[model samples]
Target chain A: MTPACVIDRAKLRVNAERLKTLCSQRGIQLRPHVKTLKSVQAAQLYAPPGSAITVSTLAEARYFAAAGYRDILYAVGVTPNKLPAINNLLGAGVALTVIVDSEAGAEHLIAFAQQFSSPLRVAIEIDVDDHRAGIRAQDPELIAVARKIDLQPGLQFYGVMAHAGASYGCFDISSRSAMAVQEARQTAEAARLLGEQGIPCELVSVGSTPTALVDIERPGITELRAGVYATFDCVMAGLGVCNYNDIAMSVLTSVIGHQVDKGWVLIDAGWMALSRDQGTGSHALDCGYGLVCDAKGRLLEGWYVAQTNQEHGIIAHRDGISPPSELFKYGTTLRILPVHACATGAQFEQYHVTDDNDCVSTVWPRVNGW
Target chain B: MTPACVIDRAKLRVNAERLKTLCSQRGIQLRPHVKTLKSVQAAQLYAPPGSAITVSTLAEARYFAAAGYRDILYAVGVTPNKLPAINNLLGAGVALTVIVDSEAGAEHLIAFAQQFSSPLRVAIEIDVDDHRAGIRAQDPELIAVARKIDLQPGLQFYGVMAHAGASYGCFDISSRSAMAVQEARQTAEAARLLGEQGIPCELVSVGSTPTALVDIERPGITELRAGVYATFDCVMAGLGVCNYNDIAMSVLTSVIGHQVDKGWVLIDAGWMALSRDQGTGSHALDCGYGLVCDAKGRLLEGWYVAQTNQEHGIIAHRDGISPPSELFKYGTTLRILPVHACATGAQFEQYHVTDDNDCVSTVWPRVNGW
Candidate 1:
């Protein structure tokens, strides 16, 4: 068997139920981004008809649409090349919603919608906390682009959308809450500004994994989109949002070699299986390649290997986690706590779903490519 | 096409010929490690009688042996689980060799050899620089292990082996040369010490990309086992071992979106296509994610991608490289210079070979998993 990616079904169910309940009490739509858990089974767990979803790529948007998810939002800024695919989905009776950031994008999308027989719903991406891809809320160009594109016959403007992606960089809960509040305010203000121009939007959306867990009481954020909550990782743990036990997915690895003198244990899992986007490595507590666990999912105490290769992970004591009662033996199978669930989960083509026991219950194939 | 991985045959041929010539000048065997390339076609480029090659895994050893390259060495330190496979390879009339550092590993190999009809060659792995997996130089237990295992029928002690992987950490010519020297001396000294035990070591191999590039004057060293030089990357470029021009492999990516307000450019190539391994990030110059280029292979000046998601790369400029370029239009295909060639190359299953004119050539498939 390929060193299959394992997902804890119980943990995922618990996470989804918790988030769904959280949104229910706050009167917000919990549109769980299925990108983090790109499984039909996992998607079906939370993808109800009215459950709005946020997708990064059109491939995902189409998949969810085919699976009966209607209110789909392509959260990333759409490009000219991908317009045709979006048009096809919209034309095929899928209520496809997209995000636009520039006048060029708005114009390109508006023109594309003109070719279509029906209107295309789109969210004008607003700059929130992260300076990644969005127009500033107060920028004159934002209103101009919106007005010009909304004036186009076939283009339907749905409101402003913003992602507090930088909220993930926050070290404390107050900082995350502040970022979320600001994101909600900026998006709401943008909607009000557009409303003054006689344009009313049905939905306003704002989201991020870090901001999702906060007491979400922000105004005008009708929908919430979060992905990593299904499977938290080291980065999320380092942020103090979730504990290591809350993480659902882990890569199973085997010990291949040992350095008797240096007390270094080498495992077969490398950067290929465990991704190298060790974003949390630069934090105050740098977990080496990953947090190591024994056969029964117990965190190995007094031992942490700090370096990795393509197929080999070196293990040693970093914070007095070595010199335990039992040293890792060759052929011992272990699980790696992934740093980024989204990135590490993308490494494998499928997942081996495991329930309470360590037995593989079922297999779930994943979709890849753009 | 999902922006297939491309390998430069011309560049690989140049690097291969250069390494072989350097070794010949110093009267050492150029046993190119097939672990890096993982291509049967690439392995044939250096095959001849006694063209001893090193492999990182038993699967790799089995691969090269089946290709009729009998003088194979599985360079990774062996444990007990691989005994059957090693014995099977020997039984199949392949001159299989393996490395062992612990008594348990040596005993396992010896027991397997006793069960097999054909003789198995074993090499002692010496801790040359206190890396990860090797026995210490002055360990008295090595002699006891060797004595207990060598005369146990159908087992022949091959020699001593040491890898100078740490040499890649060197930043300058002198430091690199010093590292190579360190690798060579330790490997040779261990071989001499073992030979004094009447082991009659026939091959004393010491190698890595850095050591193979500069050092050829190690006492008692008989062979070089470097592999990664086939496809140099940003890490090797920073180490001054190979220039960017010498790199033979790159990922062809496409522009998916652009965001001027955030100073970011999105591409189809993310961690899956272009791996998140930033091993080369902290060198003298940090190549953000990777080096960027246009569709036709023209270099992007003053710009680099700062971070990457699963399937989305967010590129930005430090010195204000024009965010708007004609070549960066939607769906523009570009070749990304990888950060670590071995790690990045392993992420893909197949390679799309193209000549200088960008004409598609033959596809090379690679083996994955343990």
Candidate 2:
């Protein structure tokens, strides 16, 4: 299929089961972020009815809502361009919740709610540890916004929310724990701040994939929004949350050409197939392009795709590593581990589910477009 | 337009004219490689009357042939999956010239030509510099295969063709030029070898974007194919072909979020908008993500996007260099230069063309799904 993406559904099921067990053991409600696996088929397997979901864009809320997902949270700050779409989906009987940070933006969402016959649910985004797209944890603006929402017509202040994306940047447990602790504390304080202002709170969303796995308590966190945990990548592998054995997605490609004299094995998978995601470069180890794997799922020992073109991939043997074969003969099918599963996974419209036996069981379609 | 690809038509026209003039001065025909721009609008502009065009796939050959352009050369090694498409295109009065390396592949094309009941022009690829594809220069088997093609029914032997793509990997001009000279000499020898075997050889194709503008001399070379010359990029900039000012295509995106503490700015132009091409990184200097530029058509000072997710980009100052703005305010438009024009340009279905004055000129649709 043009050397595009292929997902392993069986592996995804295993990953889902593992994460659900992890959350159950820790007594945390899992509200998986749907941004990673955008396919309704895959989402249905991980998040069934009564299972909460987190969406990055309102467009995704409409998509999953049409597919029978009634409860959804727009994780990103709602924009004006998306208000009409959000209203239509809500009017159609889907329960929607959105996030906002600034007073200027939150006032707009509140004003839009006034026009609707039905009320709107929203959460104030608090800056946890990563100072990105959120208000300060101790700012009076948090209570001020809560007070405004209390007085605004047709608007409901759901609670406080925060994203711990900075946990992925950490290379060790002590550092990740430090970041995760800051994440849970800041979100907990913001929720308490709004709660102290006589505002009713419904949810306190605070967790990323890395933070979800940490053995730390999110005291005020009500829902965990972990998406990429469904499809582990090299970045996750480097963080020690998931091992190489847990990766559920890869790009299936074929060896189409070669630069033998220069020790380059050209494959059909370039960034189009396996996205040029360098997320794992800062980790203790760097996976070049990605971990080169054989058709049988063994890592191509000593082999690394050092250079690439638009449609062509050039690979060579790493130092002290012996190549498996003299040449990557024509029509050699291979699987490449992605740097970020979400980025690479979005490029394809369907997933080719290869089971533990490596036999394709089914094909699931993914949704795209605005 | 959803932060998709934006093409500078004026600059593309300028690059096309510059390359055409350079080739014309050297008495060489410019056969623009269609894989670069891939847009019909860009292709039509580069193509003069009866202009020879180079394509990497049979689908491209057919697409161009149906669009009324003839004299097409399928540059990539012929594959079994593509034989039928090539045969049908040849039958449609298109002067389809295809390449052959292995005897089995050549015999397969011969069989397809016989079944189609038309004479197909064929060229034997000679390994000039890059040992990526093409047969060896002094291979006795290569000459024997050329001879057999002449005796075969429904096929016309043209000449030899070679591409020094490896020269693009050469950071120094002397090495790149030596690679060019080697390509020219070996390609000319392949033609001489074929002529010695009583095969009528005419055209000798040898050219690359890295060498097309500098080492233009190839007395034995008859035709040249340099497509990337039309839309230069950070990769071409590293090759010393064109500067950042000459890059004709870029992705126009808006800043959607930022992390003021970590100094990380998230742009809407993720890999989906900028593409996953890292071809420009292999040079002496790596263009992280790409050459970051502003909405007003100037390079963004000190701001380089170092990381990206599916729909998110993390822009930071290079080497801890401080930026002027602490916040990349929501909805600030930006233009991102791609590392490879060919790969990034192929991701979009249409281009929003703008003039030098930033005025909208025209919209051009690209043909894909071959």
Scored by lDDT, the top model is 1
Tens-place lDDT per residue, model 1, A1-370, is 3234788888878877778888888988888888886766777666655577878667677777777777788876666667778778877787888877777677777667778657888788888875466777888877888887678888887788888888878989999989888888998888888888787767788888888878768776778888888888889888988888888888887776676545577877666677676778767677766788776567775455477776677777775444342557766677878888887777677888888997889988776545
Error of 2 at B140 (Å): 4.7
Q: Which candidate number would show the highest DockQ if scored against the true structure?
A: 1
Q: What is candidate 1's CAPRI-style docking category based on DockQ? A: acceptable
Error of 1 at B38 (Å): 3.8
Q: Write candidate 1's Cα lDDT for B68-152 as tens digits.
A: 7788888766656667777778877888777777776776666667677687788887777776677765788667666666777
Enumerate residue pairs that collide in model 2.
Answer: none
- Considering just the first chain, candidate 1 attains a TM-score of 0.95
lDDT of 2 by residue, A1-370 (tens): 3464667777788888877887788798899988886878788668876678988655578788878888888876666556677778778887788777766566677667766556678788888765456777788778877777767777777888888778888777888888888988888888887777788678888888888777776787777778998889888998988887678888777665554446666676665556667677687767777777787566766676665555556677767343345436655678888878876776566788787788777887766544
CAPRI rating of model 2: acceptable
